[model samples]
Target chain A: MKILLLAAPCLLALAVPLYNSDSPRLFGFPFFYWALIGLVPVSALFIYAVFKMDGGK
Target chain B: MIAHLNWTATLVFVAFFALVTGLGFIAGRWRAGDLDDLAEWGLGGRRFGAWVSWFLIGGDLYTAYTVIAVPAVVYAVGAYGMFAIPYTILIYPLLYLTFPRLWAVTRAKGYITAADYVDGRYGNRWLALAVALTGILATMPYIALQLVGMEKVISALGFEGGPWASHLPLTIAFIILAIYTYQSGLRAPAMIAFVKDIMIYIFVIAAVIVVPLKLGGYGAVFDAAGAALAKKAALSGKPAGLTLLPAQIMPFITLAIGSAMALFMYPHSMTGILAANSGTAIRKNAYMLPAYSLVLGFIAIMGYMALAAGIEVKNPQDVVPQLFLKMFPSWFAGFAFAGIAIGALVPAAVMSIGAANTFTRNVWKPFVDPGIGSKEEADLAKLMSLIVKVGALIVILVMPTTFALDLQLLGGVWMIQVFPAVVFGLFTRWFSGWALLAGWAIGMVVGTGLAAGPLAWTPVHAVFGLGFSAYNGLIAFVLNVAVAGALSALLPNTAPDATRAADYEDEALA
Candidate 1:
């Protein structure tokens, strides 16, 4: 969990469409396309942090 | 270069201010007590239900700054500004999971700020005091940002006075905010949000429908913008930052997550949560706030429209106003500016009250003299609120910070450090109060250092070199959580024996 948290930043980086200038398209959508698809997973991780945190009161 | 300053619109703004001030004085009696009860006066009797909470929380979440800045970022930054759209939407659902719990527990214990909850929950005076100090410090610039928003409208409308009077308009407007908020506490801003939200919805709906039509259409606007931005990027070797992609995924997500954490912990935000009638209302509001987030998505896109229209804004802050003026008539533009101007009023008032509440409870009562009566508490709260507004005014004029339009991107990094003690204590009793304090100190130091350090080229605003940055504040926040956890392991928990952290859970659950 500890190491995972530091790498947490790396996961957030995938939020941008990961594409080289050479790549034409993914599924007929541009780079922004793939990033939007990952939105839910990224959000889930953030929510998980909240749940995992000790105090909610 | 500037929108016409229609006296008629100016009169409308004045009338709105006068009515709000009148309402402010009258509000002293709306949720009246003996004039001594701090909670009753400072927080609107902590009895706010759906309607008032709707307005207060809405005003708390959205601001005049949102009216101008989001679109301005969209105008200036392009695709990167889209981050706020997702962040705003994400914030609502995020709050849905956490806010109700905080609300239920706060109301059950009659806590006012997050600090009050921190003190009561962990039975740790220092930890609570840390929360209080963080809130007061964080709120000063937030209030200053609202003043900056008002300045955007005043400047866009060309309300310049003498040259020596560069910021007179903002000074005058904030002075009004100071008086009204001091008099009515939460009620002033709570009422003003009604007008502000209505105007925002009107401006946003009009911008979505009319601006697109006037600019030839959303598709044309985006196509032109993407091409223009691409052309600009090709001409300039450096990264255009917003328009062009450059490994933005982690920064965007960190910005969102860190912002969401800071959002719930803010003093004024916590004030809205605590004032709710029930945990359910807070949750419901949390869900509904996304509705506003949907509007923010449109606001961010407006920046693109401005870019496509070749709309040249004099000041970066004028981007939204100039965009609206180009698309709308003078009369409709009046309402638009009204929306933006009054938008500053609501949160400005709430921030002042949140700061006042902290000073009265945390600094004044405990340190100065515990014997201070409830009446004195209300009185002192009112007084300190004045000082907060004045401090904000100084920041506006003296500091390099911009007006209500000011973007303290570093604010999120510094403010989020308070999370461990405020929100973390909400769920765990195993951590000692001293541990919370240690975590807070380390977090503040590390976050401040990270903000001041150079990690990458992403300085908070490119000016501070790579040393100061926005997203890295999350780095500090994570460290804060770690220090707290590690310290908790090292030190045994020491909350008073009478106060088991779970002892209040049943009441909250009820």
Candidate 2:
């Protein structure tokens, strides 16, 4: 269960064909660039949640 | 043709360098411990809290070369270079899952290097020797390559002379680094890591915000970068785009996964991971270390920013330095250059210590001296660390730079072969030691042969009638696992397990 949560970011991010477009610019940045940059924090959150679930204080 | 040294910039660079030198030397006393103990000297006594581990590992992994090279790649090849982004993003969860288990086991069993753990688990000295030798082979060249990053900044600061004399500043800086590291051990880099990371954070964040604003914001920068890439593509008749070309998608993802797998396999990364105070510290760092990735994302973007700024240099590695020189004031450029040079110093220290630790614990003690005392072990590791650094320095000064770069290229492919032995053994003792050793041997030859022979040192190659190309390391790793699994099913387990199943559990959970 914890492994699934942690693998979320790796799966979603490495699927380059899905989100490789320059369209849907975020604040003057392309979707491809901004999305990957934004995923950095999201990936951290997923790992943090797994940590908390594992009885981490 | 060397440019004139800017006095203001040189002074700022010197000031920062001197400050870090003092920190490096004083670090010996910072976390007071018996320097005679190999654990203390090699792993900082495993006393680093979550935050300190974050800085130390962050500074260790995202090296000065990474700071320079990531942007250089983006500058040279457009969005293809952003493979490092996904690679960094993918690495954290992998760390979150695997490394805590490694920390727990190593703590319980007093295993200093991954090879030591392999020896303990498999009870096979030959297999452990393979792991250790592969580590040293991969890392020694890496230490030399760190100097390439420092040399870039040193020359950029306009320190010029004859060939030997021109490298004098870099040599002097490394000598100071070697001395403090010898005196202090892991703490030297760990302490200096604090300053190195802060300087990097300041400069990268400053560049991210200030560079875009200087170039009239992200929109103009991307447009200009796209235009520039398109112009280059037209001239070269090769596909380049603001986004990934269809043909590039496979290599990009494969490179990302291959690199993430290889990153922690290196002994230096293991050194930083093992130095944490507890499994929870390593776990906490999983979420925290991505902050550096965010910094790296911005750093990668600077390559595009360099294009927008019309900065031209014969070498792409100079893009970041050139960007700073053109965009920022002279003094701040100096500060940025110092940040990069010190960045190089931290990893070189850690890499040498890591390889040296592998030699002392895995090779020398087990093979050379069965009853070596802790003090002698620590002393030997210290001496070995000095030798590794001097050897790397000589490699840089005497040999052509491409030799080190080529070896480093093979280094990744070679290092990943150790993965199945170390990481696989973490979860299951089902695989036989001999099987794992055979797998490693086959993987090394195949990976190196393909990389050096047919692939021509390119990272990705077309595999087995698959139209798409994949990273050679990943391809080799798959073959490694297949061979190990097939042989494990056939061969009886010969070596008894040294660690119990519970040994892999964190203390809080256990």
Interface RMSD of each: 7.3, 0.7
> For residues B1-510, could you state the per-residue lDDT of candidate 1 as single tens digits?
224456765666666667666766677677665546778767887778767798888887788887778777656655666666546545655565567767666666667777777777777778778888888877888888887788777766667655337587677777877887877778777777877888788889988888778777765676677766676568875344333354544466567667777887778888876778766566556545556666676677677778888887666668887876677776677678878888888888888888889888987887888899878889999999899889888877876653322235556665788877766666667777888788778877776655554643232322145442347667777677788889889888866732344443434343
Q: Which ten residues in a row have the lowest lDDT in candidate 1 chain B?
A: B455-464
* Residue B183 Cα positional deviation in candidate 1, in Å, after optimal superposition: 1.5
Please give the fraction of native interface contacts (Cα pairs under 8 Å between A and B) kept by each candidate.
0.03, 0.84
Listed in order, the DockQ scores are 0.10, 0.88
TM-score of chain B of 2: 0.98
Tell me the whole-model lDDT of each prediction, alpha carbons only: 0.69, 0.92
Highest lDDT: which candidate?
A: 2
Model 2 residue B184 lDDT?
A: 97
Candidate 1, what DockQ? 0.10
- Per-residue lDDT of candidate 2, residues B142-238 (tens digit): 9998999999988888878888989899899999999999999999999989999999999998998899999999999999999998998999988
